[model samples]
Structure formats: structure tokens, C-alpha cells
Target: MRREIGKRILINSPENENAIEVHNLHKSFRLPTERSWGLKQAIFNRLRGIKGYKDQKVLKGLNFTVKQGEFLGIVGRNGSGKSTLLKILAGIYYPEKDSTIIVNGNLVPFIELGVGFNPELTGRENVYLNGALLGFSNKEMDEMYDDIWKFAELEKFQDQKLKNYSSGMLVRLAFSIAIRAKGDILVLDEVLAVGDAAFQQKCNNYFASLKEKKQTIILVTHSMENVRRFCDRAIMIEDGKIAAEGDPSEVAEKYMSLFK
Candidate 1:
């Protein structure tokens, strides 16, 4: 059923057990007008009454639904609004008029590297901070603290500032925390692998476990292999709208055919 809230619409999923539902979603970004990068030029532009920005629509009218425990893959070329859609689903961005979004469960998103970590803080401190963001109490984090550090292989560096860690180390720690931060729906973007080959294998196994358990996951990635390997369904986005959606292999093939 679809209802309206002002200009926006609320689309309830047809599947009573859906994990996500979206209807006529739209998003746009306002970019500051480019001018000479100095206070003098800034003052000049303002004095002349030049419009200070332009709007770029990143997502057009889009609609979709994800059933409970579904592993859904999203794919698109660069600048196709795949990331924007993910952020909307994650509640980091709101849609334009008449756009609808619904999430039926606790959602945990690992959409970007270092999404919830403070660079100036020690790894240990950042862990607690991120845990809190995921709604874990300090006591609950303490119970799982050792496991998180151990998985990231940064037990010795937990006291070190995150800014000092290498890119690989940072992702490792972030990935470790995301896995431990359990939620009913998991949203990930281009994070299929991390660390060395051994760790990559571990990640594969972890995905397998999740698949077996029927965990609800939404992934955005360029890796067709991962999409085919893990996702039971997939969607291709083009120009901020869904171009195709259905079986994982079929959607992946359609995405590849665009190159041909």
C-alpha cells in the first residue's frame, strides 16, 4: 500500500516481511558555484548577485523492495547514483518530493571506509565510539572488545591513533567492527575483501555463513564475481534509476553487456 506525506509518498512493501521498500525516490545535490578561490573573488561574486550554486539531480524516480533475509546486489558505473541510493537507504540522505523509503529492521551500514571512526582517537577509543553508534552499550562493547581487536590483528595497536594506521589497517579494523556490529539489515558498498589473501578467504567464508543463515544484505560493488558468488538477486542502476533487476547472474550479465 502507498500513502502520502505531503509531497512525498510512503510505500509499504508488498511483502509483509520486506526488509526495505522504496518508491519514486529522488535526490539532488546543490553544488557551490565555482569562483576564484580567494576572499576577494568570493566578495566580488556575492556583490554581483551571481547565483552561488547549481543543483545536480543524482537520483531520479526509483522504486524497489527487498524481501526479508534477501541478499540483494546493486551495480552501476561511476556517477550513476548507486552510492547515493545506498546513502538514502542508510538514512544519511533524504529524498526529494514524493519520494518514499522504508526500512523494516535495525540497519548497519559499512558503505565507506572509516565511516564511523575518529582519526585522532586511539583505535580502542574509536572502537567504543563506533560501537555506541551501532547502539551497543559500553558494557556490551567490552564483552566483544577483545574479539574485535583480535580479528583485525591490531591488538598491539589498539592504543595507537587511527590516523597512524595504514589504509589497509584502517579498513581491516573498520571491517572487523562492522562484522561484529550485528543488525537485522546489513548494507555494504565495495567492501567485499580486505587485508591479505588469507583474510580474503576468511571474508569469503564469512559471506558464505551469512548466506547460509539467510541474512539480509544489500551490497553495492563493481566486482561481478562477488555479485554472482554471493547475491541471489541484483539490480543495475542507470541515470539514477533502475535499469534492470532480477536474478543475480542475469543482472550482472546485463551490466557487462553495456561495455560490449
Candidate 2:
């Protein structure tokens, strides 16, 4: 699918120019209904021509391409499939047949904070575990351990079990690890701030630094302010389809119009 992104022609852009591309993407979920629970009930429902489940269509055929060094924001309201779409791009979920997702570089997605975190493990142990999940060797994790500890400001709490840490403490540790384990393309699902006021400020600054580095980013967020402030382009999704796309400011304005 070809579309004009500002003055550039997306389809004609060189492969190296695009950090990511998605085409003809579709997704749906089969939600269980009453008769789906019991074997006998399911059989009876099937006999009566009932599928015993409701198909929840989440994403329609979506198409877009993210150029290298572009900070693209994905904006949507609740239940609009924003997170679902991100997961599909992160390879956590798959779309239907004929869907195409192409990535030009290594992708690191911070879609869920601390997805593999173990509450029973000590803060230090969890760091290694999470790093391994990110495909880092223990040796590599060891090399970066001190910096992670220092960035999180949880050096003193390293010995403590994660369950004992405050919510803010957990966010600090997780966010610290995510940024340290960098990749060619970064996908963030939220505002990247969920802790104390000071730490939130640090998070903002970190994002600013990333912007200065010309990092390619795909951010899925509800914050229009961030869309306008950080994104060169933004796309708004509604009912599992692209509702609007292009300049972040214009997209943000279209998104706001729905509520007015």
C-alpha cells in the first residue's frame, strides 16, 4: 500500500530507509461463550450450529511504514486495539494469513514493563533473568550490572526480594534495564513514566536524549502532548483500522475531535 507521508512517497522509499513496515494486517479473537465451557454443552451448541464463541475483531487491514530515524506515535483510545497492534509488531502475537510485517533492524519492545519479573527473586537476580530474556548472555548482564543498579538508584536494594520493593522501585529497576539493553528499533507502549516525580523527570530526560540521537521509535500512547512533542508522524486507530495518519499535530487534532 502506497501513501504520501508529508512530501515523501512511502512505497517508493528504499528498504534501508524504512525501519518497519506493516501491510494488510488483520487480527481477531474468539471469546468464549456460555456453551464453550462444558464438553456436553459445546457438543450441543455445535449440533445447533452455534460456534459457542464470539469473534472479536480487533484490527482490520492496517498498512503503514516507519522510516529510519522517525519517531512515530500510535494514538488510540481504550479498546481501540493499540496495545494489540504493538504486540503483533513485537512478535508476541500473529495476525491472520497474508499479513506482512517487515523490520529492518533488531527490535526491542518495552510493551509490558517487567513481563517476566519474578517477585520471589532478589532485585539483582531479576536483573539477570530479565536480561537473559532480552537475549543477553549472563556475562553481558554481569558487565552491565553495575550501571543498571546505579541508573535505577536501587544499588542498596539489590539484596532485597522484588516483592518487598515499592511499585516505584520496581518501575525504576525495570525501566533502567530496558534502556540499557538497546536495539536498532525501539517500541514503547506507554509514556515510560510510572514512578516517583523525580524519576519521572529522569524518564522524560532519557527520552529527550533518545530523540537527539535520531533513534527510530514507535510509541503507542494516549498522551497527545507526547505525540505532538516527540513524534514526527502519528497514526490514530479506531475500531481496528487506521483512522488518521501523518503529521503528529494533525493526527492528534483528529483524535481529539472524537470526544468533542
Candidate 3:
């Protein structure tokens, strides 16, 4: 069966305009009910009239709008579809038909950290590679190379291969590079607190600066403290639908109540 995909439009607009507008957004995936051990087994199952898959809905008829320079937080439990919604907004997935998503201004998404890193490559080489993926020219990377390393506190590891780095180091390096990308809308997922306590302090300072500058950000996290601290508004998703929205404090309260 052919699935109809809805429209995702990008445009540049004035500061007063909404940065993102999502209407009737929905998404689903076809999950295999039975695993085919081999090609012959798959053919036999098909011949036996077994579809072997079921449709699983992740988001259902959601509607929301984010204004320019607003910091928005999305809170939900695991499997509640927060990441799926961010992926759809980042253009990595398509929504169902009749759903419309309109985005104004340039968007930078950090859905997965270190996505473009090569394990065999040196840190310096990986920096260039990741920069290229983010649309940065070699000259721009060169200008920021020292700053990036300084910020990540991995200046001595520049010549080391990425495979040798610890998980915390990798997250720090990726996050340092990601923040350098300039965009009107920033989409982040579970990246607020990374590395050791000192590193987390740095992240807090950086986010504080962004808040002070009125940067537009969409953050998906389970941290209600972060929601209250950084978000101008917040939304809570439950079972593929928006269960609560509005002021950050109210949404955070509603989210915490779900566990009780």
C-alpha cells in the first residue's frame, strides 16, 4: 500500500511570525510481527497469507505552534513518541497525509550526537568531517578549531582516534561542535546534561546565554527542572497525543503527576 506523506514547508519570515506551525500531525511505522529467519522462510510466510507486520501509531493528530525566539520544552515518558516528533520536525521522517508542518527560518537539529563521526579518524579529522556535514566550509572550521577544542576541554586529544575516546568525551566533543552551528531554530534531544559535573556546568552556562539572547529552541527531555528553568512554554505528550501544554510550571506539574 502507498502511504501519503503530508507537506513540510520551510520559509524565512519576520521575527514576529511563528517559527514553527504543526497541524494535524501524525506518524506511524510498520513493525514486523514475525521475524523471517531467511529468504525462503519469508517467501513461505508470504505464500501462507501472513502479512507479518502491524501498523504502530506514534503520533496522532497533534497541533501546536512555536513563536519566534521562544524556548519550548517537550516532556514525555519512553515510547511516548517525543523523539519521533522531533525527527519529523527535523525532516528525518514524514508525517501522515493532511498533516502540515511549516517552519520559518533556518533550523539546526541535534537529534543524535556524533552521528557523522568516524571511529578510525583522528579527532581533528572528525571535526572537519562533522563540520562539513553541518554545512561549514573548511575555512570556517579552521577559524573555530581552537575554540572548539578549548570548549570541549579535549585539546590534547586532537591527534587521537575517536575510537580511543570515552563515551563522555565523545558526547562533549559532539556537543561542542553542534552548538557552534548558527540557526534560527535549534532542536535538541536529551543533550542538556552531559559529561562530568564541571562539563554540565558549562552546558548550563551556555543554555543560560541562549535563554538570555532569546534564541528559539525546542528541547525534548525528561528533566522537569530543565523545563522550568529554560522553557518559556512546555508540552507534555502521553500515548501519542498532547496531554498538557501552556506555562512551563503547569506543564511540568502535569508531567510529574503522571507518575503518581
Which candidate ranks first by lDDT, i.e. highest? 3
Model 2 local distance difference test score? 0.85
lDDT of 1 by residue, 1-260 (tens): 13233132234453568888887888888687775566776678779987566779899888899888899999999999999988888877767768878787778887775667888999998998888877789999999999998988889998999899998888888778778868788998888767888778877888889989999999999999999999989999999889999999999999999889
For 1-260, candidate 3 gives per-residue lDDT tens digits of: 57799999998977547999999999999887776666776787789987677889999989999999899999999999999999999999988899999999999998987788999999999999999988799999999999999999999999999999999999999989988989999999999868999999999999999999999999999999999999999999999999999999999999999899
lDDT of 2 at 96: 69
Clashes of each: 0, 0, 0
Q: Candidate 2: how large is its RMSD?
A: 5.7
Judging by TM-score against the true structure, name the best candidate. Answer: 3
Q: Candidate 3, after superposition: displacement of residue 171 in Å?
A: 1.4
The clash number for model 2 is 0
Ranking by lDDT: 3, 2, 1
RMSD of 1: 4.3
Worst 10 residues of 2 by lDDT: 1-10
Q: How high is each candidate's TM-score?
A: 0.86, 0.90, 0.95
Q: Local distance difference test, per candidate? A: 0.84, 0.85, 0.93
